[model samples]
Target: MSTSRFLPALRVMLALQTVALLLQAITAGLLLSTPGGRGLHNASAGVVLVTALLYLVVAILVWRPGGGSPRAVAPAVAMVVLVLAQAMLGALHMKALHVPLGVLMFGGSLVQLVQVLLARRAVAA
Candidate 1:
């Protein structure tokens, strides 16, 4: 695909990642108060992982040494790492770390999404 298509693709992936993370957070809350919460949370974790991987792939495609910024790659990598760790922590029943990491992931994803959207807008203008 052309370079022009990469940005929009990246943006779509980021948006999906952001939404997946948000759903993870919601299901986490459900996990506490509802009987079926655990299953929902577990399923959402898989969705989050998939979205993170997709985001990483798109981020790499969007990165061009001379034309596109490499900065996006770092956070995309971080998201994958964090999501893996988050899954491990959750599976290990390490709430102390898992909870905080989930929150951090959500916040970071939100920031990344905003940055991508702004970058696209800047390019358009």
Candidate 2:
């Protein structure tokens, strides 16, 4: 019930999200670079799938405004949207869209990281 308690959970979420995001981003990169390669697309999809699942868990932890402030909610929503888009676009696997999709995932991940850092700083103070 204490704000302090949430700090550790938030930190863990941050680390997990960062790892998952990076993996997914890497997968996207791999796919984007090898559009004609089915093997790479499959591998990328696998990574994206796993990372998305992990991201879901992280999303839950930060689902609500822990301190009753809506500061992190926007970025969280953005993350969710990007996650869905990434999954859908990835499933489609259209070669032309690979780069754009990759960019979206990468940008979303960076935003998530920024949000996590901000949340951590809020807790630290």
lDDT winner among the candidates? 1
TM-score of each prediction: 0.91, 0.56
Estimate the overall C-alpha local distance difference test score of candidate 2: 0.57
Candidate 2: tens digits of C-alpha lDDT, residues 83-123: 66766765676546756766766666666667666866776
Question: Residue 41 in candidate 1 has what lDDT?
Answer: 99
Q: Which window of ten consecutive residues has the lowest lDDT sum in model 2?
A: 1-10
Q: Which ten residues in a row have the lowest lDDT in candidate 1?
A: 1-10
Q: After superposition, how far is residue 43 of candidate 1 from its true place, in Å?
A: 0.5
CA lDDT of every candidate: 0.88, 0.57
Q: Evaluate model 1: give its lDDT.
A: 0.88
Please provide, for model 1 over 10-90, each residue's C-alpha lDDT reduced to its tens digit, 9 standing for 90 to 100. Answer: 889989999999999999999999999999999999999999999888878777632466788899999999999999999
